[model samples]
Target chain A: MSDKLPRLEPAGLDGWIVRLFNDIDEANLSWLAALANRCRTAFGDALVDIVPSYTTLLITFDPLSLSPAEARDRLMVLLDDLEPDTSGVAGGQVHELPTWYDPSVGPDLERVAGQTGLTIEEVIQVHSGKSYRVFALGFAPGFAFMGLTDPGLDCPRLDTPRQRVPVGSVAIAARQTAAYPAATPGGWNLLGRTCARLFDRQREDLSLLKVGDEVRFVPVSREEFERQGGDITPLEERP
Target chain B: MTDTAIGVRVLRAGPLALLQDAGRFGVRHLGVTQGGPADLYSWAWANALAGNRWGAASLEVTVGGLELVAEKDLAFAIAGADLGATLDQRPVPLWERVVWKEGQVLRFASPVSGLRAYLSVRGGFAAEPVMGSVACVMREQLGGFDGLGSKLQTGDQLTVHPAGPSNNTATQQAPSGVRPDFSLEPVLSLLPGAQIAEFSGQSLYDAFNARWKVDERADRMGVRLTGPRLDCRVRSLISEGINLGSVQVPPDGQPIALLNDRQTIGGYPRLGALTPLSASRLAQCKPGQEVRLKATGSGAALQEYRAFRARIEDWV
Candidate 1:
């Protein structure tokens, strides 16, 4: 059964792909968390980066220091040392993010309600009810792909992507949810707004959400949102 | 100017200009793309000509139109594509070091040859490092002269302190052999990846045999090639870390060659990855320019890479 725990394959010159699972689920993420930890501990400086996504961990290394063959052998050895449960690495730091869930802030919130056949308040309640694990972070800096959102809130993306999605805009697409760390062209379904400064270059810890970190979204009032540097005005107020 | 004036000041900022070094490493896990010189070969040469070591930060000017005023007398080198560069309205030769007197103007006009030109100063450009690198990724807003990952704007001041005579490398000219002519079509080397077997046999054949035209919709993130639609049975998989030259195939079937400022992770199936040196060659390609891919074994690619590194060492 352990032999079927995915395999480490070579990726071009300076990277290795650790194919952990075929599907996205909690167990796969737990295994990924442990495997990523083991890779970091074993490879140390030789490892350039470990990109953890839904079911794969791509380990980029400095070829000048570590060869793919050696990296594969070491990783296999480390995998052997891990326990069967792999639950030791399951827990991660939980971060609570403050979000403004006004229909004005999230223009698509009403539309999502219409699609999911749930009340606006219920949508917000179910959305913020559970802790979401970050499956991956990409498309933009400090942008974490957190999921599997309440299946009830499942919604399709916009037919045509918006020219620009507001920064810190909390959005849901398919089963995953995220906040746009920076204003960029996005196609995700907008549901709310967050005042959390997801990324700050000045800080030693630049990104607010890491790959394995658990995230919880807490709703805030408009006054509280304004106080926390949210400068959004509703579309209806515009001329 | 202040009493201790250092480096050059932006006289005119062109379409796009950014400070780049080797790249930001060991941080992709945090969702940061590696920001570095798009044309690594040219960047290395510019640094070499400026008497700076490899991995030194240099100014990468895209589509030209950049002008700079030397605040202090310094030795600077221009390399990569010839962007109709001029010194005080006189033609300035590229791929060589030139002594820049105080207040002398160096201007780069529209591209006469290449899409990007590299300007390297002795002792490297002085920029505060973000996440251990001065490479500027505008999307990420990290690493640059301002440490905010901004492209060069007019009136932006860049700090540079030239090395003393003792530390300066005595070469003023880039060796003729390594200089690449950006005007010609490039045949890139592809290191076949795990997904290579997953693609259709005809698609694989077409990938190599067909000439992929560079689509206008290209940037630091990736270059979308308009050629054969590489059909693959596997559509999307679990997103994974993409490297500097990962050639990913989107649902549209067009291959987008990921570049220096590409996202940290991608879910699209990939045909393979371009060799590092091949990626540098592809960076010079302008919109509408055509390029082809040739499969290469890992051993052979490593040999070429090692040889290139050895050559750079010998140049120093």
Candidate 2:
């Protein structure tokens, strides 16, 4: 059955090809993750980096060390012997990030509430209600793309992106929620602010979360946020 | 052990001077960009001249104007660009070995030949490795002389491994060739990507025929080329992992040649990717330089790359 998985033509860039799965869902994500873990464990040094996205995983390797054809054959063998483990979910740390939902902290909270036709408090409630899964850490360093936000709170990104989004900012767009790891230009709809540093250069592990980590946001009062030393402002201001 | 300690004091820092080794590998999953010398050819040559192995940490001086005073006698070599260098106020040749005595000043004025220059000592620079590399990534703030990704500043001290047995004679044949004329028009070789057929016929014609101008909005991440707007039928698609030199054409039609500092993944529709050697050439090009893209198959591209690598192996 694994051998039957669709394999696309090689991308013109040397030693890379596209492997597409029919569908992407929670069940498939687990299968993909388990398969990736098994391949990494089995042929540890053969692979360079295996990045799992929302619907796909890109396994990049050293062309000089291992040819793409050989890598593809190895992947097929690992997938054939792999058993999907659905029970590996729900074991990540529950990080209670101190968020200040004030208008100053969240520049787009009012706009988001207006767009969704819900009160600001209702928007906050819908946002903090459920635990979101960390689909991947990409788009930028320490930027975690957590997902499956409440369908009611889904909002499209601003047509004109904010020139700069502050670090530790909690934002939502469509079905995804993310914490801005650093001050970078972003288009996501800002909902609140968090003091918990999502990325720190001083730490051994720079990113606070990984691809398979689980995340839950806990809203906090302005006083509590201040007490937690959350006064770090964006290095650059948004236009 | 006492004889190996060589020191240099920074008198002036160029636009950006950072200690770089080969690069940090096996950590992209952690969202770290491989921050090494923007020009690998020059970096490798500098190390080879110093009789050090590949991946040794060397000084990556960009847009020149860097000056250093030797605190002790040291043997060093300068490779890469002709960054008007002067040893004790006398013109010192580029891409050759040179000896400096204690208290001698080594100065690199504004770039006369190329954008970046590499200076390597007999012994590699003494810097603590961060994440198994001394390559500096300012954006990520990891890996440098201090392991903090900080650029060299005036008054900063650089420590090098103690001077080894002075092999003042050239051990390897000099790379003989005229410096690439950056002022001349550049022809970039590109390999057509998966979505080549997705582009409009007129766009494809223009892509191959038209001369594009390198836009000023260029950096380590990418260089945006301004030319005929290429219209693609595919407006949007799933974002996937992007490789080095991926030529992504957005809605605006201008093609962006992604480089080392590019994002890990992107969704933009791409025409194709420039070959590795072509990318190295493109890195040195200044803004407003005319560039024409030549379409070549992957097989030919790989063969050219192999030939270059083979030459490198001969030197090793």
Candidate 3:
């Protein structure tokens, strides 16, 4: 890591954006997560929220309590004594999630296979072969946007968005893949369904995936999926 | 049970009625949008007149179709748009606290002036909190009267736990000078944002100089403004969490002023953001109404907000 200082810019009147790096990468993500931790520790109950994205950390505060300049000055002071963020030191919880990749469950599996000129089994092997890192969570609750998928499996979003994508849908868009926390209108290319429920408000920790965690998708059989209480994947294929 | 549960019973429910507090905060990482009252100015005033501190939950009535039959004698106040409200068949003026007796009917007909009206009880509407906010977000299916994001329905009762002593009358009313007139053109105060420099000079000039009309395509999510094309250098930016009153300009040049119920993260480049108070006024504007954007400093905006907050509560 270099000794470069993060540049602070005004996001709005009451908020400020800390630009840690110019692009999204593993190092920048680690740095952003570190800065985010510092801000969280510093702001405590005074801040409204601090949102971390690819290369920027936006800090929004209550106008009545703290002014933007005041928040900025505090961050600047923290920056002076900050240490280089070692990416995997803080968070590296690896999540092994199971996915049912049957044709019925993953409608686009065949299409993705045809596009890559690889067999369905080959695509599954490449996808679950290595652990993918969790870059960020946005769009929906527990919707972790992970990156650097196998180049062969990289694909663009559907030309038109699907009005309704089912819950627990494991899908890919560009080099990124995510599991839909809830059913919503999405444009991602669907590949499979997962038994893992990403979000449950009743739980103490509402989201299973957090920023800086690692994820791996394990392909499971229809019988195994059904045995795990997944109703979407039927035992027998429809004739 | 009846002795402990003193609440007002519902007679009629307007087009859309919901209970809202300040807003949900510190939860955007979960992709939870901040849910709160669309018209904040009115919501705050209503709370103040009722003698409750700020951030209290209040009823937000849109386009005025709500009616309430008081089951318990209560002190309440109404603010925001003149929605043709009446108490027991007599016209009840807005921006003032009115005493209510048991069995008195509080009915709202239609919009005489504004799109939404705020009504606050002496205490505040009682609702189970979800994710730390009682503000209702129907899209998320969380936080409301039943702890689920359901709009106010006919026969739904509103429970209020008194914050102060149950008084027969509230002597305070919004001063005449402080009351906003919804009929005039809205001059929204904009604090130019990060994307302000990316916009073409001509586009920036037109954004402030030209009069823009509020399009019919408006909701708690955002209000679309129809005006001259606002050309920007960048096609899109990385998606970031949006705050209340963030104004994003799309490729079409028209700007959408995002409100309280907006998505947690968005990719569109924002020309700037409206002050919280300006957003409150914009919420009251009807479709096709003309509005102009004015640039203001962030410090001035903070000061203005502090002054407004001081008016309702005992703040030094």
lDDT of 2 at B271: 84
lDDT of 3 by residue, B211-237 (tens): 999999999989999989999987687
Best by TM-score: 1
lDDT of 2 by residue, A1-239 (tens): 13345353344434353444544344555665676677578557766666666555667665555554566677777756566556555454456666877667687889898988999998888888888877766677788888789888889888988887877789998788998888778999888788888877667887787766778888898788888887645334434
True lDDT of residue A192, candidate 1: 83
Best by lDDT: 1
lDDT of 1 by residue, B114-157 (tens): 78899998778887789999999998788898888899999988
Per-residue lDDT of candidate 1, residues A1-239 (tens digit): 13466776667788888887778886677787788878888898898888888888888887767666777788888777664235543456689989999877798889899999999999999999999988898888889999999999999788988878888899999989999888888888887899999988777888898877899999998888889998667633223
Query: Which prediction has more favorable TM-score, 2 or 3?
Result: 3
Clashing pairs in 3: B14-B65, B14-B66
Among these predictions, the greatest DockQ belongs to 1
Q: Judged by DockQ cut-offs, is candidate 2 incorrect, acceptable, medium or high?
A: acceptable
Which parts of model 1 are misplaced by more than 4 Å? A1-5, A84-91, A227-229, A235-239, B1-5, B166-169
- Give TM per candidate: 0.94, 0.89, 0.93
- Candidate 2: where are CA atoms >4 Å away? A1-5, A8-17, A21-24, A38-43, A72-96, A201-204, A232-239, B1-6, B163-173, B177-184
lDDT, candidate 1, equals: 0.85
